[model samples]
Target: MDGTTVTRTPKKAALASFMGSAVEYYDFFVFGSAAALIFPTVFFPDAGNAALVMSFATFAFAYVARPFGAVILGHFGDRIGRQKVLMFTLVLMGAATFLIGCLPSYDAIGWVAPALLVLCRLLQGLSAAGEQAGASSLTLEHAPDDRRSFFTSWTLTGTQGGQILAALVFIPVVALPDDIKYSYGWRIPFWFSALVVVVAYFIRRSLHETPEFEEAKANNEIVKLPLGVLMRDHWKDVLRVICCAFIAAVSTVFGNLAIAYGVLVGLNESITLWLVVAANAVALFTQPMFGMLADRIGRKPVFIYGALSSAVLMPFYLLSMSQDNELLTFALAIATFSFGYAAANAVWPSFYGEMFSTRVRFSGMAIGTQLGFLMAGFAPSIVTGLGGVQEGGWVVTAGFTAVIALIAAISASTARETKDVPTAALGLTTRRAQRVEAATA
Candidate 1:
């Protein structure tokens, strides 16, 4: 491709990536909302007081499948092409989500109800394991050297869009009478995922494979076993990404655990869902700005700021819910999530993907983030088990947030600054050597 085509491809890739991620996370977040509000009653009715924990555990099941999914999907992503693998993940997630909507309730089917729910959730997890990594890698590769972070930021911004869409769809469902809400209102959002999947599917299908991957393939640099190459060369980067990825738990705490906590603290269920809608709505705008900022200042500082700010602001946000002030709660929610945690969320696509060469970038990012995201996946169950959704659970939740944020910050601080590096020079030891190799080729 020529320079103009190359330049334009990034925009197309970014849009396709944004749509795919929106569809993927929309399906994922719908399940999260249902797990928090509906599944305890619908899927785990027999568990008594443990029903909520069990419901959240079903939410975690996808995370458990994620690492394995990362290995399987990431291999094909690197081996075949990012575009093809992404198409499969999008369809798989949509099918699994739609199946969950079709499942019988625990009342009608006994243990088979929760069993089927877990199975669908695992499929969701498997699809998700590759979605972000593939989207990020593809967009980053297509993006200009100077604008990679800004372009790739849209992938995460798409996630915020998904969360907003999910919460909006569920808000009315939560307001329905119990009989209707429990009977079928919950399934509408899950079924709505099918429509979105079709939309994103066509968008992604029209986009071409990334130029970086194409160039690498043309030069015979594609690896047969990407995992082996990743372990042999980029293991430390993978470790850093895993630690840096712990910040994702903050999202679970905000989106899932906080909803249950708010209800526990006397906020209405719809109000809690509105809070999610509000924070993520603001994030739709803020995350991209943070991405541009990362491109200018460097990824580490922006990511670390996001991490530490989340730790500092989380307690105040949680505390506000019990203060009987809706305005205060809303303000704190925006500050804690949109302005604080969003910075790290926005920058990680570039920060992590830039660590590996195009050859293993998919595998490295997928395996690393999925492994770390296990904490994010199980965070609701773990914190709730420790009383995060109980009367005085905010303290436990806040402390957990602080610990993960600090660890992510410390890990991020150790990473190399790639803000000034050329697109082709990234992952190589030095710019001069990269140029020499290019000339020799």
Candidate 2:
């Protein structure tokens, strides 16, 4: 190793980001699993389909909080630093999730149970508002110049880990007799977040700030209002990111809503959970390979292909789930998620993060993506209202899925190809780009 080289820093940064994201999403996914499998029964036993809609609404409530959380968290993340903001997000998510485990059910507390659940979901939303953006920004800045996508991919890969863990846990809990499952099996997952949070917090806290942030601070380039600079100089890119992020709705549709849809269509609860586990487990390996492909080719083709392919394949996956053929459903789940959508999932960290300068990268990614994710947060409820989970229900959701994917692909198409751009010169303003070009010349 070279004398001045901090050789282990990149690996450490990726590990920290990965671990932090895993814990954050683990708590988030726990709530998602419960919303589908447990909330309708435990929190609103008497309302019938209205109860399911209401339960999904509580799930969507976090998304409503997300954009707002993004603005506040993004501000501090950009100004105060990504590391501190991420630590706060981790702790906030844990507290909210733990409280959820303690909340009483509708049988005991009526509407108050769901209301409190919504409140905790809002806190989770706020914490999630910054998790991906902060982790991606920190990882992207720390990574080797030529391998940004491969390294930053771990941040999102951690999310797959979280989802997989969430599903694996809910699998057993969902299988218990209803008396036990509803009584306490569900709460176990939420309470377990306390342990995961403690582990993630220590790992994240020990990580040093990225060198890019330090350089910006030393040069007095760090702005007091990163949002202002981001708006003034990078509004177009922000909008692009927002549209592209709509692709996230596909994920929510697949991982969260599909569980309910499976149960509604008569698949066993554990089977649905297994579908999630299978897709995400395959994604754990496929995502990094997609990341490597992004680095070798470019972010554009891989992301665009992923977006379009997931749209094309989602209908089949949903339709397969509605059928009696469990084998076909499982196969479609892997093909749709692992090979198709995972392409976009694996690459967006670098694709989005590279669009801004370090001074506001966190805010830009956080605010933009959170705004777009509103569609995701509300998708299950919206599609459920549209009869998305009923027999022959694949059409409504399939259409919704395609439109969002088109929006993302179109948005991605508008951006300049950025694989060749250096990390420091990324997201340059007109003047900044000219200055960089002249310096190179």
Q: Which whole-number lDDT from 0 to 100 does residue 207 have in model 1?
A: 95
Q: Give each model's clash number.
A: 0, 0
Clashing pairs in 2: none
How well is each residue in 3-91 modelled by candidate 1, as lDDT tens digits?
32333398999899999999999999999999999999998766544899999999999999999999999999999999999999999
Residue 110 CA error for candidate 1 (Å)? 0.6
lDDT of 2: 0.90
Candidate 2 residues lying further than 4 Å off, grouped into runs, are 1-8, 434-441
**Candidate 2 lDDT, 1-441, residue by residue in tens:** 122233337788899999999999999988888988789899996666688888889999999999899989999988888899999999999999999999999999888888888999999999999999999999999997789999999999999999988988888898799899989889999999999999999899999888778777767788999899999988999999999999999999998778888887889989999999999999989999999999999999999999999999999998887679999999999999999999999999999999998888999999999999999989989998999877777898889999999999999999887787777788986677677656755
lDDT of 1: 0.93
Clashing pairs in 1: none
